[model samples]
Target chain A: MSIQISDPMLPELYKVTKIQENTHDTFTLEMVPKNKTKIFSFLPGQFNMIYLFGVGEVPISISGDPSSTDFLVHTIRAVGTVTDAMSKIKEGQTVGIRGPFGSHWPIEKAMGKDVLLIAGGIGLAPLRPVVYYILAHRSKYRKVVLLYGTRSPDDIIYEEEYQNWQENFDITVETTVDNTDSEWQGHVGIVSALISKKDFSPTNMVAIICGPEIMMHFSVQELVRREVTWNDIYISMERNMKCAIGFCGHCQYGAKFICKDGPVFCYSSIQETLKRREI
Target chain B: MKMLKTILENHPSFQELEREHLKFVIDNAENIEFKAEELLFKEGEKADKLYIIQSGKIAIELFTPSRGSITIQTLGLNEIVGWSLTPPYQRSFDARCVEDSQAISIDGKALRIRCEEDSKFGYELLKNFTYTVVQRLQRTRIQLLDIYKIRT
Candidate 1:
């Protein structure tokens, strides 16, 4: 059942070992080869183009929490054919795997700085690794704050992880729903409102954001207004990714390939692409 | 009343509304309070009112039995909540009061009647509502693109 595309480097025979449904229409697949437990090491923000036999392939961010390197994980939402196939993939089914590729979170630079992590909807997948890395190296960063927003209480991904993050003493976590829900007991507003209410100084803060482009743009603007310099902010951009290598133009947004050149990038570097609505 | 005035003064849509038209719309609107987790309206229900948040949050939910319910969006204070004039003219979706909330709402039936009585104000209101829906639709399309990749 392995149909090789032109590229030989992209591995097509990885296997799924665990599956956890996160919410309606979304699931996280924990994968490894049925033949072995080991998988390739990846950067904190890298993604792999996952293939599901006849269903085709789509780019997915690695969602393995950094505190423990258990298995390669991807939190996927069933939006199109490829992702729909992904949702049905059960443990023991075979799925394709490609590069643990792309620029990673700058873990070294964030050391001793207050880290602000902002995510919208399912955009938290890309930031999950960064959270893991920070929590793993707990003493390195002074203060960690995670701000997340979703369309509703049901749409929030990683429910258990969210609770753990909320309870962690080393980190301050705030949640917001675009509209509130009966079970949503916290704030009910845009994530930007949470940023506004926090007393964190952006002078010593490094902000990383991923979500809808509009949300990222707005959150970045809010962070800037709070004195977070563009140099200190990082964001993950989403574009169609065909090749994890730069050869495919699908993931191009300006000069970068979100799969290869990024998936994670500094705000100071990608300003030009950020302004273009199409990209 | 002060909260209503301040919210209207601060809202972007009201910024350019003619003073007379603004006052007219405001005078026609009345505040309604809902108990926690109350159903404002259900999908396919008659479109009878348009709402603006005064306080608390409202969740616009879309439900499919197999997949369960997903919150499509949330509307908060100072945000407009429905497009009662839009096609289907019935509620295309469901809105639920997620918390004990207060909202300023105008009767759609009365507004439509008044709009027929005076097309000028109707035109302005409809123009604003259409623009807001278009902007939100564009944002939703992109957000869905980024977040959803269904395997075919």
Candidate 2:
């Protein structure tokens, strides 16, 4: 594999090409490299270091399709100082783009196998690319199911795309909201609740799970109970990713640097690491 | 009407019982039908029996003086509702028909008397109800999380 790791200390300039507001506090930004040489590629589960001119940087997942090389897409929720500023940045503005770092979901190994994508809240953004990839190569995978849970109907993102995906692809999309109004006439429960309701061959299924740490923990348990092996289950871990490269120690888990080693990992690889009480 | 054999083999609450024990309950069961907007039983009324939905929808509702009646859950085929036949023997929610529905109602008093006679069979029903209770509990807890609240 010819791997070209980018320089970590400095970030390249990327101009915001398009902007779309998702929710009251979340927005999606499409950026393209200002310098032709900085037009880098990334896998489904990798992340980018987004930097505002004066403020610091934060890691946001690449939420666009791999096959579509026009622009890099990221769905960001304004949570802290850096993200809050990035969310406010207008279209056509230039921002710093760094390495599309970390490992990705086993989309390759999942060929001819059933795929289950379980996400909670903002966790759905990172997994969006996987859905795009499977849809792009529909016949390569056997079945794809997306089980997503949010706080309520209003909190759901990509509502239009979900409708399109279900109608167009051979994919099953199930969603649950924690709270619902009378207007919301759908499943009201945790995302994990939908696991047993769906039909999939557990032995032949590869599950990619993301969300809050607690949600991921519970989802892994549910998948295991349904006979999905830990080896076939992958999860994306979120941490304080300061340097897109491994040098900054902020994103260390056990002996691995999340920036360099993974944002995606097989459950078996991190089982013991998650079990540790605290560091 | 759906057959007793189907209920014995597939009802969410009673399907796990041994055939002999399940047969005894099936003997006491009666199939009931309701039209949309009709009541199965009102909240606070005597909990006469437990129901295993055979078809259609039954809404478990709570009637508040202010909000009137609000549906808590709408249960359908093969799902069980009304476990009030257990200890309290008092209906907890007003179960009403949302869509024309059919269910197998097992007489609570007779079922309780039967349980007293057969402790092993009673234990099986207890286990089944526990599962339903836990499922409801977990769903409620998820709602309590109010997961969609935009964090600042």
Candidate with top DockQ is 2
Question: What TM-score fits each model?
Answer: 0.65, 0.88
Residue pairs in candidate 2 whose N, alpha carbon or C atoms collide under 3 angstroms = A151-B148
Give lDDT tens digits, candidate 2, residues A30-144: 9888887655677889888888889988889999998876589999999899888887898899998876788888989999999999999999999999999998989999988
RMSD, every candidate, angstroms: 8.6, 3.2
Give the alpha carbon lDDT tens digit for every residue of B47-146 in model 2: 8688877777777777889767766555666667777547678888898887788988777788778778889988888888888899778766765766
TM-scores of chain A in all candidate models: 0.92, 0.97
lDDT for model 2, please.
0.82
- Report how far off residue B110 is in candidate 2 (Å): 4.5
B4-109 per-residue lDDT for model 1 (tens digits): 6566656666556778867766776777898877988888888978888777778777877865555666666666777576556698777888788898786677
